[model samples]
Target: MFRRICLQLHWLIGISAGLVLAIMGLSGGMYSFSSELIQLIDPQITRVSPSNAAALSPAILLEKISQHSPYVSSLSLSDDPEQAARVGFMTPQADSGAKKFEQQYLNPYTAELLGKPASEDFFRVVLNLHRKLALDQGGKALTGAATLALLLLIISGMYLRWPTTKSLNWRSWLYLDWRLSGRDFLSRLHVVLATIAMLAYLVFALTSLSWSYEWYRKGLNALLGNDSATISKTANASRAASNQSPSKALDLAAVWTSFRTEVPHYQKLILLLPSGSASTVQILYLDKQAAHPYANNRMVFDAASGVLQTHERYADKSPSAKLMASLYALHSGSFFGSAGMLIMMLVALLMPVLAVTGWTMYLSRRR
Candidate 1:
């Protein structure tokens, strides 16, 4: 009875979410190599030689950019050290009441403006489609449903893959006999791979749900002891202060120096400069030596005064936030670097095979 129930739920969820899962898997596979793909599609945007000397100040870069487009929204520096700095601004069109925002690049060292980087790269588009499920407004619901389905699928799949009394032998665990024929071979492969990928799938599904549902995020945060009120107050205070002292200039270099000094082990650092009316500069970086995968730290600074407003270490995050963040890192394989990412990409590509084989096994039994 238990076995039968498991099989029914497995197929039900698989049939419903299979196509969506396949779409996500395929797109994820493509996105796994996104960095490389972006470079190949548009060499200019991806390639930039660092300045032989120290780059121009953020103030100078902002001044030059504002001269060309005064209504700029925000400017952000590339997290990738090789990439040039980017300045974004809004331009008003006669037909539209609101201005359209765009991004431009500049040589950090020379402060010379580079041509606008193309946003329509192939991999980027694929990533966007995958993340949003290609449905815009409906995408959120679809993605949420798919995530829930995946959770069910993972649980059911584990049961199907569990070693039966007859299959406890070494041959059943590792290899499929050629003499056993096609059906047996496929069933074995399906079960084995599904077993291996189950943990990763669970991580992906749960983290995705955290993004789609506010209740899920808030509930989880509450469980982890993240103070909602404190976070809100901090955000509000940051905004008010920025508005009051909008003219005060920030020292980007000093901010970066302070961040590095504070988090000396972080190997990769990304600084996002505030533009227009915003007073906070955000920095995100990964601590290579951290014990946990979600050890990517985020710090927000007062753009006007360069005062450190919020410094959130991975270890210091609320338990819920840490879990959520770690799940993302694990799912994306960002925690493990290139080799782990490749493994995840391969697992994503193999998911369709597992899904199809499971269906085939059921159909064979039904007939």
Candidate 2:
């Protein structure tokens, strides 16, 4: 009776939440290779000719960018001599539908403006769909519910497919019986493919919920011993300090010099400038031999004096902190490497297959 109830719940959730899961999965799969895809579209903007001369200082690059946009929210510099620096800006929007954030590349050595990237807007839409179904708060809630339902579905489906002692065999569990017809074949194919992809789906459902629901995020944070309140307080303090101060200008040259002197080696360096009235500047960079793409060391500096206030090395972070930091890498499978990323992407793309097959079987049963 319990098994029957579980099977019924599994199909019910599969029919209802499965569509949303498929949408999420397909969007995620497309976005997995976003960087590679963008580079394929236009390589010149991001890539630069290697120059013998040292790259220009952050202040000079900012001065050059001032000709295009007066305010820069952030700057990304690459140690690879052949990569261009990226500058982010908060441009004024003409209307409600217009985009407010913008980014453009610069020749770090010559300070030449490299126009905005291609297909960024399209990718932005895809990202929005994955996160919130492009409907903002309401979509977030719906997606969160669906993600939670997906977790339950995975559990119930696994339970329903558990083999009895007599039927326990590699062929029964792993291989599809193509000889069977109608519903029997469908059942065999569905269970077999699902079993193959079960681990990947489990990872997706578990890691993705961290973004979809606030309660889930907080719970994960607590579980990982991340001090959310402390982080919030520090951010609030920075904003309050900015409001109390009269000047908003940052000494980019001094901060860059200080950073270079302290940590001279890095593959890529990103300086996050203060927006609005914020008085602190946060800089993040990856080591020459970073553990993963997301393993970034962080530093906070006073915008005016360029005085180093705080620094956090990725290596020095607590286990929980490191795990929390690595959530994105784990979710996208980049933590493992290029092969893992491709595998995860393929698995994501196959989500629609599962949904369609499940729906077909459900409808046929109903008839």
User: In TM-score terms, which candidate is top?
Assistant: 2
Candidates in order have lDDT scores of 0.68, 0.81
TM-score of each: 0.79, 0.91
lDDT of 1 by residue, 10-106 (tens): 8878877887887788888778867566566666764578756666656666667666655544445544457676665556678876556556666
User: So what's the TM-score on candidate 2?
Assistant: 0.91
Runs in model 1 lying further than 4 Å from the true structure: 71-81, 90-104, 115-120, 166-174, 228-280, 285-296, 315-320, 362-367
Residue 99 local lDDT, model 2: 36
Task: Compute the lDDT for candidate 2.
Answer: 0.81
What's model 2's lDDT at 82?
Answer: 81
* TM-score for predicted model 1 compared with the true structure: 0.79
Worst 10 residues of 1 by lDDT: 238-247
What's the C-alpha lDDT at position 339 in model 1?
81
